[model samples]
Target chain A: MPKIATREAYGKALVALGEENPDVVVLDADLAKSTKTIEFKKRFPHRFFDLGVAEANMIGTAAGLATAGKIPFCSTFAVFATGRCYDQIRQSVAYPGLPVTIAASHAGITVGEDGASHQAVEDMALMRVLPNMTVFVPADAVETAGAVRAAAEAGGPVYIRLGRSGVPVLHGDDFEFVPGRAVEMRRGLDATIIACGLMVAQALEAVEQLAAEGIEVGVLNVHTLKPLDVQAIVDAAQRTGAIVTAEEHSIIGGLGSAVAETLAEHYPVPMLRVGLRDVFGESGRPDELLQKYGLTADAIVDAVQSLL
Target chain B: MDTEGVVAELAEKARVIRRHIIEMLGEAGSGHPGGSLSAADIVTALYFKEMRLDPTRPDWPDRDRFVLSKGHAAPVLYAALAERGYFPTEELATLRKLGSRLQGHPDMKKLPGVEISTGSLGQGLSVANGMALAARLDGRDYRVYALLGDGEIQEGQVWEAAMAAAYYALENLAVFIDYNGLQIDGPVNEVLAPEPVPEKWRAFGWHVVEIDGHDFRQILAALAEGRHTRGQPTAIVARTVKGKGVSFMENRVDWHGVAPKGDQIVQALKELA
Candidate 1:
């Protein structure tokens, strides 16, 4: 079992994409090392830009690059990429449908002791509402690389949420990524647990624990938040009588709300949204933060057990 | 190209653009006629004489890029694109209508020639700076041009972009400040005076060029000088009247975003002719 950080996957994928496509350009707001784009910067200095501590300007520049037929991949902390530069992304990139891939690393509480200010719990909500913007929360390092490749070929504005810490490499090299589609990791008739990002691994763990206790749990990894896999959601709702959604984002207006919205209109079920409560985070270790925020595998197990 | 001939042609085009502005605003029943009319000459010179673009290929890779940072004045950009053959000239009358490509604010997806969708002031300049730097990194020969309203320069982001552009030495970027001295509220001096604007840009390390907004020759020469400029970006501060051709509308802040009435539209058009 090999371990790879999602940020490293982004760097590797960026270099590969740059090699394959001349239009692929990378921009960083002086976080090339933190965001893991330093590798690409070293290899292709002509195709890389260091925009200093100006995230808003970086986003706008990425939009301009897109307008000039250059596919720009901007890397930075998730908080700065989404929170600090929302307007820039909204008007310049998302509004115009520019093919700019905002590779947001250090997403969620897994950003560790850097604390609450660095953790971006609302990036998904902020990006998903904009028209023509695609939001992708890849489950692990392998999937992060796949999502990066998919976004480059998608030909539109995309937000790829990644984490700073090393996560298990669940998806193999051959695992294909299709935008707006969900991947079912397991099949069970009892109930479904929809998850994304770091929580996907926890949900799988919960499913394994639940299986031993004679409770079958269906686990589906939902990567793309906008243009959600509505059909898969309906199918899961029909097959399973209950649903539990887990993510590293805020429970409000995120993966949980997106799932609830889909089910409320079509198939109503006993749904439990497993995510952070309506509160900002503080300084804590990654594992401690996940436990304090109730974003652990044990929490998923408890949530699924309660539905029974 | 002969600079005089280009300026004369652009001057004539500006007249047609003013006529189009009044007609479009009257048809839409509402629009920013003052700023739009003021910006007509600058946009006309860019599309007709400065930019290397094919109307049929709106997304040409190496074509010079133009962004309307002060996006509320889309009529001027629309007029330029319409004259440049981006879409049918007849569609100009349908400005701001439901389902019309020409939106009240520029929408890059709907409109053919729009580079970025902008309406919120003080943001387009940063986007332009990004485009300019991207071109430099790619070693592309194309340049980027952005139009900013003097009133809109109050945004902090504008200065941030100014500093960044100069620091990056983005000489391939050219910015035009339509110094109309009037915003929607009233005279810009009374509202938020942005005087010593050229000095501010120069302090930020830009190659500042002050010129007559309506003088096509000055506009062309300034653009040429901006190209020859090295080690920093250039800002052409063009002094312009709010509503140049229409006697009643000129220098009137009230006309900043107001459409002309039935008789007034005809009068404005006649003056433009």
Candidate 2:
């Protein structure tokens, strides 16, 4: 499978979206190149706005454009896009149910070299708690493109978290995406491994490794974290009787927390979370950081084995 | 647009809006009256004399937009919308009550005429800039007006939008700094003043205008000047008293967010009368 960063696919999808709908406008807070809104800017300069390193104003402006019947896509690093402008998103976008797409890239510990300051490990928690916000953490480039389309069609605020590192494409080009529904990648009787974003690909590796070890485990790719596919999770919990959740975010508030909350309320199961513990990421290569933070396929296998 | 009869009509409308502010705050038992009262004339001019609007078609795409960036003063906006016939005048009593469309802040989804929801300061200018940019993008002729509080500029996002508005050369956008000179903590100047406001907006490439916010002719002329100016958004710095109409509450910081009580409401209504 080819490898492509989700941010790359986001930039391409935005260009295609702009071509399809004239009402689809893109705004960037001076990260046009890194966040990949630069391609959209090149294609539709008239519809593109550079808010110049001002994430709060960019978010508020996106809400304004949404109010005027425009589907505005705002892009920046996850740290600035969410943490820097959380109140702006809450008041101006989510409060009014504006159709503003906040496509934040460089999420998780994988935002290498920038260290803890630039990475956003709690963005999903921040967005999921909002009343009108829909959160999406796509697994790969194909899913990233589909998530962008779904967010554009959605009527309210959406936070699509993308990554900086290139990830293995786990799905085919013709893969169909239905938002808020989990895709069961593999079947197993022992336990279910649920994951989102780039961690899904890593979990696939864990599934294969567990299968080779005379153990069986299922993998559920949960892309939509806000309107979670709770039925799929409950069914997986029933079918497997144990659960392991993995993500490239904080173990405290990201996918692990969401899945834990769901399973605890509906169907309780022995679970192990694999992500960053209550700590911060330092400047390092993406692979080294993943290894150090226990966010790799090996970590998922360890978590599932621990549950057993 | 500022004929003698029209000015007289707007002045009366401002007085009526002020009365509604007092009455609504009195009923709600806890809502902002000072800023709402301070902005009565400017909001009155926009609703009655300046901005183009149709009461029945609140969703008219071509209609001009009014974003109350200083959303704490929502009573003034609700009063203007009601007086403009967007809703029944009697609904003013339901300002902050449960099940009412009028929220404590101007919620665009709940209200018909509200262009965007805002309570957090410093974001309205950005939203207004977005609206203005959208107008240019769609080739629409509608103008976007945003009213920002004097202290709201402290949020830092206001200057960011100020710079972007000028960068985009948004001629159809006009923002008003409701320089009422008072905030909750105390006088705005005494507590982290965003003073030299007009000069700041000017430095950020806005066409600057100063006026007594309570003056009808000055308010109208500034609106006209903004419309006549080209290639940049206009910043109208209106010097205003915090509690403009009520004698005892006027310039009093205590009234900034407090609702008028029994005797206070009666006195405020009498002074307006």
Candidate 3:
């Protein structure tokens, strides 16, 4: 079986969308090669814009294009897209409710050799808080492609978080992606391990390990963080006595925070969050950082065991 | 458009806009007056005489668009919008109050005529550029306009947008600079000078125009020149005086954001009358 990264899916989807919609435009802030928007640029030179290290202007221009009824997909490293140009997104895109799809690539520790500075773990949190903003984190390449299509079709602001490192193609190519729905990957009764992005693979591995120990650990892939499926989380919490949420972000405000917020209001249960704990990531290898930062399969299994 | 009669009408509108700014600031007790008063005539000319905007249909697709890049001076734009019938003129007194759409800065979601929410300086031009590019891609004939403050131009992103607009030869886009010389800290010469603004814009490949921003005839004439220019974007460097109408606040840094007291408001309105 072949494996691919989520960022590649973004590039593929951009080409596909560009072929279909003439109003679709691609913008890059000097990372066309890295973010994989180069494919679309090559195919449709007129529709592609290389913004040259101006992320703020890139986002604002995307908003502007949307105002003129054009769907603009802006691609860049997640750090610059979310952290550096946050205000531009807030005022220009989100506030006006423009249909701008921000395809943020190289998210989280999975970005590997670029180290902590390039990896964007806090994007989910930052994008989630903005008014009228939609957040989606795909589990694999197939799902990322589907999310890009969904964002393009959806008439509003959407943020698609993608990764640089290659991972298993768990979902088949024919799998249909929904914007605000969680996909139940495994069935169990003991505990539910909700995960997103690359963490889904770790979570599945944890479930397989826990099954050997006679623990029926369930796994759920929560791709959409905003407009979250509150009922699915409540039902999962009801079916399983405890829940373990894992993500590549700070525990203070991100995927874990969104899950916690929903469960607190609707359904209360014992929960354990496995992610960064009020500390900045340091320069290290991808796998080393995952282990050191407590984002591995072992960490997920431990969190589930602790919750039980 | 013949600019002679239009200039006189816009000049009178600019006077009323200035009066509106002072009165509203007095009611609010705190608001930017310097930049707002400086930009009154330029914005008034765009809204009343230059742009093809329908006050009734604030979201008309074919209508020309304007983005106030320097948004702290929203009072001027708001005054112009009210005068143009985007909203009621009497509601101007409710500026910056709780539950009012008239926020301290422009909020596009809350206000109908505001194109983009701006306050954090140096981002609006990029947004206007986006709109301009969108118009071209969509094959729409409507042009886009943006106004910038002298002090706000100090932000590097403004230059980034400047370079991009000229690089694209966005002939449908026009930018204005309210060269009032005064910012919050002090005179721009004392704080951070943006001298030879027209030369800088020309160097960036834009069709630069130097005009007396307060002279409504000159402002309209420059705008007319921008319309016929075919190859590049136009930047009108409108030299203006901060707090152009009010006697005490003119050229004074202290009046940058401070509203006048009740007695002062009476005197200011009297001057306008």
Candidate number with greatest DockQ: 2
Q: Residue-wise lDDT of candidate 2 within A1-308, one digit each (tens)?
A: 78899999999999999899999999999999999999999999999999988899999899889988999999999988999999999989998899999999999989999999998988888998999899999999999999999999999999999999999998898998898999999988999999999999999999999989989999999999989999999999999999999988888888899999999999999999988888888899999999998999998999999889
Least accurate 10 contiguous residues by lDDT in model 2 chain A:
A246-255
After superposing candidate 1, which stretches have Cα over 4 Å from the reference? B1-7, B137-139
Residue ranges of candidate 2 with Cα displaced over 4 Å? none
Taking chain B only, the TM-score of every model is 0.98, 0.98, 0.97
Q: Where does model 3 exceed 4 Å of error?
A: A282-285, B1-3
RMSD to the hidden true structure, all candidates: 1.9, 1.0, 1.9
Which of the CAPRI classes, incorrect, acceptable, medium or high, describes model 2? high
lDDT of 3 at A126: 94
lDDT of each: 0.90, 0.92, 0.89
In terms of TM-score, the best-performing candidate is: 2
lDDT measured at residue B193 in model 2 versus the true structure, 0 to 100: 78
Candidate closer to the true structure by TM-score (higher is better), 1 or 2 = 2
**In candidate 1, how many clashes are counted?**
1
Candidate with more favorable, higher lDDT: 1 or 3: 1
Give the distance in Å from residue B69's predicted Cα in candidate 1 to where it truly belongs. Answer: 1.5
Predicted structure 3: lDDT: 0.89
